[model samples]
Target: MARVKRNPMRGGNKFKLGVFGANADGCLSITRHPDRWMADWDDVLAAAQMSDRAGLDFFLPLARWKGFGGETNARHISYETFTFAAALSGLTEQIALFATVHTLIVPPVYAAKALVTLDHASHGRAGLNMVCGWNQPEFDMFGLTKPDQVYDQGREWFEILRRTLAGDAAFDFKGEFFDLKGVEGAPGPVQQPHPVTLSAAFSPPGRDFAAGSCDCIFTTFTTYDDAKVTIADFQSRVDKAGRQAGIFAPVHVVCRPTEQEARDYYQDYAVTRTDDAAVDQHMAMKKNMSGSHDPAAYDLYRKRFAGGAGSYPLIGTPEQIAEEMIGLNNLGFGGLAMSFVNPKYELPWFLDRLLPLLEKAGLRI
Candidate 1:
């Protein structure tokens, strides 16, 4: 067993920060701009190394099986997440490496074994972001149907993975979605019990799954006041289950030296050069298949969808962005997962400008 490093996700930073979706072209932005992220291997590796050195907490990759049909055909190419994490494990230290997995597609036993391998490879800096399968087109690519009882299947899938990762004696398990006998794996994860598990949940069943099974839950919000209500509700569920959890939000940021520059850039990429067809396909599918956002967001936030996959917007100067973050922290959000137009080129600037304000505001040390 390798020496286990302290998990940065659970570190003392009052508001944890991470880079999201660098594995996919254009990331969360549905843009056709020439400067859009190409997501080549070299650039991806550079982004991860940059984030690790910048003291960002984690690097979360997207799991996309196919691209949304459009001019750019966003996310058509992506690295398999488990392998991606394993590859990065040896190259970086400090930052957590998270692999996004769809429960229905990847068997629990295989996922468990692979995660332990990642844990060993990373010497304990591995995390899992469990996503109940969404995107019917992606499922169609596998010739599989998205089940109505998806969360139920996810529950059983997690249970099997959990037990297998425990490295206990072999056990038999049967559930509505899966049936397995003599399931067990070797070399448990470096993080005691298991590595940190997260779920991006928005619907009631999804939220319940996160409350019951995850170390943290990711959700989208329209407004702070609305988010407060949702957070309270989710936290209450966690409390009732006699578990502790953190609530996180995802954001797309465009920070600049001046507010005008930030807004201008956001307008340029998200609206002016936005991939209209891509946005249409992405939003229509999301609205129909996933409950990842507020209902109103579908109509009101097309620009936001192009900006960062319908994540909360953080477009402003460092001070303004920091103020919004501080407000989020005050509103009980544990942290944020952020996306940029091109993390390899933009992340350094974001950190150089934002980290000091966050530290000064006591959000980070």
Candidate 2:
């Protein structure tokens, strides 16, 4: 309902870059290694600065209500995303600040107001990523139960928030999950008509929700070839729905001087010296929530557990890794979101060394 003229992340760049979940516990690397762990003010602010100076486009955080228990307590103590984004907005420039929220937990009226406030704090640089509640234990902790129809509930939640942000007159809405009475958000978002919104949806209903309600969509693929089919189909679906949205691919990147070096880094950090307890707990929760119908689906998520939580691994020389992302660009991917184990240590190298190569290839500005 809000008028979105041009996507901030896609203003001129064909393939934009964003930092995913770096503000929350290494984005699920599930390790205790100090090098790869994060969730402190200094670490988060530093990474945001690097992304800002390096011309990265956005910083998206995870909304983890609870952690997967292990020696490390994976994702156990995440800083709240909304507050984090609001605070970080004061320290950075250019890069968008994204706060993730669980639709089941955040009341639509309050959630809409919070987003508008953050957009003002960022001077119109705020965005939202919405997720249906998963992790049954996480819900139980909040004295709640997982909804029977998660996507349907989320769809209703999104509609309420959308109208709350865009409506010119006082409005009342009644949906399956929400009911509002003569309420309107005032001093609307700094970004006319509202800040960017994103949804991470894969199934048919989920994809349809994204097509109709979001300015961006976050998703993943098993491989680059698989991406061509998936991205094209999703794009067509969005077009048919009369919405032009960007689908940003999520991936784990291990770029070094050579393929062997990259493999060695991945093996040392994410595999060989992996945090077994955390991985097991994470995998169990994923399996319980996912209900993987086929063996193929199970194997795929199982591998994602071992890797960095379902992100396609881009491991090789810097140039090789850049080229791999370029391939996603070829597949019609609007952009890429990265989850790094040691973003503070590694992201600068990407900006200094790898980004130039990508720019030369015409993937970035």
**Candidate 2 C-alpha RMSD relative to the actual structure:** 3.2
lDDT of 1 by residue, 273-357 (tens): 9989989999998989999988999899899999999999999988899999999999999899999999987888889989998
For 1-365, candidate 2 gives per-residue lDDT tens digits of: 23223435646777888888887786747655557666777988898899988978889898897777777777876888889999988888778889899888888878899898888878778898988747788777778888878888888887788778886888888877777799788778877767888887566666777887788778767766767777777788898999788888678877787799888877777766667788888777776785312225446555455557766788888888888877888778888788888788888877788789888998788
Clashing pairs in 2: none
Shift of residue 9 alpha carbon in model 2, Å: 1.7
Best lDDT among the predictions, by candidate number: 1
lDDT (0 to 1) per candidate: 0.90, 0.77
The TM-score that candidate 1 achieves is 0.98
Error of 1 at 214 (Å): 0.4
Q: What TM-score fits each model?
A: 0.98, 0.93
